[model samples]
Target: MIRFETAGESHGEALIALISGLPAGIPVDFEFVNRELWRRQQGYGRGGRMKIETDKVHILSGVRHGKTIGSPIAIQIPNRDWKNWEEKLPVEAGDPAKHQAVASPRPGHADLPGALKYNFKDARYVLERASARESTSRVAAGAFAKLLLRALGIEVASHVIRVGHVELERAATWDEIVAVTEKQDVLLSCVDAETEARMKEEVEEVARTGDTVGGVFEVVVHNLPPGVGTYANWDERLDGLLAWAVMSLQAVKGVEIGRGVTAAESFGSQVHDAIHYGPETAEKPTRFTRHQNNAGGIEGGISNGEDIVVRGYLKPISTLRRPLESVRFDTREATAASYERSDLCVVPAAGVAAEAMVAFIIAQQVLEKFGGDSLDELKRNYDGYIQQIRNF
Candidate 1:
């Protein structure tokens, strides 16, 4: 089975990503992987951390001559700010005076619970691992997943749909979503300039108030053929897997598949997509078409030959500059929450992370259905499946 894991703390020397079970002969694109890391750092309301770090992946194993060799892959992204933290966060026991302690737990962060669980007097260690900075490694791994999906003619992208009260007025077309990634600068990752401007205003207001804001982003997976996921088992459901993956990201409080949230409040006729048959094409191998995609390209836990839509509802960053009411971790007495250098908004960044997770999940499903040890073998298997569907 295809799987990945990430290691390293937020302010550690570096973050590492390990991926296994990918077919051999998949080309490794250094520029594309670094670009994914770069994209994660963009967006309005980012904090000083983004300024301190320039994330770039250094491959350590499982790749040679720019191609995978059918073994586990290890990727490392050095933290540029590690120089400043080397003394404070040394691996070996160092001078206690050099250590910075998080005396109080932040109200909405993992600080208190993590400390309580691990018997830590300081929440600093908890903060290091739970920080969104870990997503950098995920984006790197997701970049590799994207490479695999790309070889199959599938693409994944995400865009901001709402920031505070300002929401995109219309549904973004696939082309518009793809265009957002090609821009020199990404402002909220929204498809509409006017809406993104409104989002910027929201961020500016939050900054002045010493507060933060959160919003929603939608991930679209295009050119995915039907029958990628199975309904034979409840756990193998595609929507369930997508929801679990997206919700695993930090700050993502909710996950929505297609119009799932709205369908709950609407009539069945208004929510369900109508089907029609048409000429078979490279894009639509089955020659089946849908009148609308309100079902979100999934029905009965399987892909139905339409673009898959998944939305993530991100909560505000837990660490606040103004801080919140809390008790000291050591004393258990009343105190203001620990203040940290944090962003005023990170919905756009969260969206990028969600895209990575969504890509990884879809890639896993693709591999599960079309297992192969090499790229050529996988494509041949996938092509044969497409022909089978076309015949059906």
Candidate 2:
């Protein structure tokens, strides 16, 4: 029963993440984890918050001497921006006049509805928790999951497939995804140089217009063993879980597995991947192969020894530089929506977040199938399952 939960506000003192159910003896990689956090803050069109915050995880509990001890792991990422807001949002009650309040709500944000539900006078409280800043904690958790999957010969990577009107027509190879995503300098993490250039132009146009742009990103998981997810229950299905995880990201409006949405418009024969037999080798007495991956490495709610392809569609940043029309909470008079410091585009960042989410889901499924209280015990069970399948 692997699980995790996150707490803290967008501008709170620190973001907190608690993850449980990991077996003992899984070594923690601080460098890799920090690098993942760095990746989340990259990409063009990011706001000033990225410049202010250099996210670094501080382990609070659950491990000692750099290895898990079979307990819940806790991590904290301090908010550098909290310093400026401390007086305005102190834990202890302060002067009402000193606290910042938002009388106007952003049109596309959670401000209005959240304020109404909480019976608040304004949107300040709602915006604090609803901000995408919370994903920072999720990225930290996902980094651990990536480490777990790496030990099992599985890898996860992601890239932007579209930005505004610019889109990649061809599917990216595993090598291409790794190459582009790993690059320190990229135009929104797009694999194609020409396409990425166009995406940059599209971003520039939106920035000039004081508007925002949305696009799609694809996450790929490679070398994952088959039969990781179950078909017995709808909640246990890998596709459903993956979809839900990706959709949980802020501003992500849609999710797709393999060629999911496309398959609906095409005939069954054109959509499904055909099975083929391959020559046996010493390590494997029998082999199965698929020339196409339209099914995205999953079929009947289980991994099928192919690359798991998931795509997330992100809407434009809800907080616009040029505000939209809205009514003021107090005045009830029509006016421009309250403006918040926001990005002109965030699809590339969303892709990175999606990668973390997908990795977390796969990690949970792996633990569920290969249950163990220690890394060594889990490995032995996993190896036995692989051997059983190889000889089938």
Candidate 3:
């Protein structure tokens, strides 16, 4: 099975991503991978960390002459900020005086629970791993997954739908969503300029009040074939897997598939899409069509030949500037929560991370369904499946 794992702390020497089970002959695009990393650092309300780091992937193995060789892939992204923290966070035992302890835990952060579980006196270690900076490695790895999906004529993109009380007035079209990625500067990543401006105002207000804001983002997977997932087993359900993947992101409190949240309040007729049949075309390999996509391109745990839409409801960044009420980790005395250098908002960045996760999950499903040791073999298998669906 195709899988990936990430290592290294937020302020460590570097972040590492190890991906395995990729077919041979898949081209490696360094620029595209680095661009994914760069996209993760954009958006309003980002903190000083983005300024200190310029993320670029360094391939260590499993690729030669710009192509995969049917082996494990190892990727590394050096942390420029590590230079300043090298002495404070050395691997070997160093001077105790150099240790910077998080005397008090930040509210809503992993500091308290992580320390309690690991028997740590300081929450610094927890802070290092729990930070959203870890998502950089995920984005890098997801970029590779995107490359695989792209070769199969599938594309993934995301956009901000809401920021605080300001939300997109209408559903974003596929072209509009894809256009957001081509812009030179990304402001909140909303498709509508007027709505994004409102989001900016909300962020500005929060920054002035020393508070943070959160919002929702939608990830759209286009040109995905039907039957990528199976309903034979509960764990193999596509919707459940997609929900779990998106919910795994830091600060994301909820996951919604299509109109799932609102569907609970609506009638069945209003929630379900009507089906129709049309002649098979190059763009749509299958003859089946839907009047609407309220099902989010998924029904009964499998893709249903429409764009898959997933929304992530992200909470505000946990580390605050003004801080909140809390107690010292060692002493029980009540005090203000510890303050840290953090963002005022990160919904746009979170959307980018979610896109990567969705891409990885879909790629995983694709590989499981169309097994091959080489790119050509995989395409042949995939093409056969497409023909089978078209003839159905």
Candidate 4:
């Protein structure tokens, strides 16, 4: 079984990840992993933390000279801001006077509940790890997952779809997305120029008022062969796995596959993708086809030889300079919620994180479908599955 876990606090020396169950002999690209980490720290409305940390992955184990040996892969991303925090958050016992304390819970953050659950008198402990800074490590682990998927000809990418009140009307093309995303330099990382400009303006407005905003992003997986997910088992549904991962991201409230909630309002005819088949081509062994794709490339919990599209809806950041009215858990006195250094909007960055999660889940699903102790064995199994389908 493929599994992964992360460790370390937000202000600690670094974050760590352990990913297991990948087949051996897959090439590992350090630069690609680093690039993903770099992409996660970007966006027009990022806060001081982004300016403080330049993410880079340190691969300590699980590969030999950049190829997987099949052992659990481990990665570490050092907290650049740890220099300033070392004294306050020292690993050893101290008077606790030097540490950053969070007495007030941010309105939308996990602060209050987490504190209550863990019996923490203050929320500082909870927010330190709960902070989106933790996603940096997940993105690192996902970078490796993407590398493995790419080896099998699977490709994943994401872009901002909507920012606050502004939404882009058209879907971006592969070439258009690749041309710019390969560089990963733009702040909004949006394909529509005007929409991106408007998003930046909105961020400026939010920042001016010390408020936060939210938006939506879509992650797409292309060039995936059919039968990579299972319909026989509910647990093996790829969409379920992908949704869980996306929803785990901070501020993400809803996840959609293909048409999503819109399907509920539509008649069956409008919601379902009809099929037609014929005219076999070199690229298509079972006759080139696809009358519609409203199902979003999946049927009965398995891929249908079409691209997978999943969009995530993110709510505004919880931390606000202009605090909301609330009472302290201990005193029960009316007061403004505590404010923390935060972003005005992070949908662009969230897009990158969503892609990481999508890629990781898809890669895991692929592994589950085609098992092997080695990359060559994995490829053999995959080829056999395809041949069986073609001959059927």
All candidates: TM-score: 0.99, 0.98, 0.99, 0.96
Minimal lDDT window, size 10, model 2: 280-289
Give every collision pair in model 1.
none
CA lDDT scores, all candidates in order: 0.92, 0.90, 0.93, 0.84
Question: After best superposition, candidate 3 residue 90: deviation in angstroms?
Answer: 0.8
Please give, for residues 1-392, the per-residue lDDT of candidate 4 as tens digits.
66789998888999999999988999987788888888888888888888888899888889897799999988888998889889888889865788777767777788989998999887888998999888888898888889888887788988888888888888777666665567646678788888888888888888888788999998888878777677888877877878899999989999999888789999998988877777655564344357767777788888888778889999999888788887676787888888777788889789888988898888888887888988899889887887776775
Task: Assess the local accuracy of residue 150 in candidate 1 as a C-alpha lDDT between 0 and 100.
Answer: 97
| Tens-digit per-residue lDDT, 175-274, candidate 1 | 9999998777888999999989999999999899888999999999999999988889999999999999999999899999999898999999899888
N/CA/C clash count, model 2 = 0
Candidate 2, residues 1-392, lDDT tens digits: the string is: 77889999988899999999888888999988998888888888998989999999999898899988989999999999999999888899977787888779997789999999999988988999999999999999998888888887789999999999999988788899999777877569988888899999999998999999999999999888889899999999999999999999999999999999989999999999999988865533237878999999999999998899999989999887788898889989998898877888888888888889999999999989998889899899888898887887
Misplaced by over 4 Å in model 2 are 281-286
- Winner on lDDT (1 vs 4): 1
Taking the tens digit of each residue's C-alpha lDDT, what string does model 3 give over 1-392?
Answer: 78999999998999999999999999989988899999999999999989999999999999999999989999999999998898999999988899888889988899999999999997999999998888998999899999999999999999999999999989999999999987779889999999999999999999999999999999999999999898999999999999999999999999999999999999998999988998768898898899899999999999998999999999988888888998887787898888878898999899999999999999999999999999899999999999998888
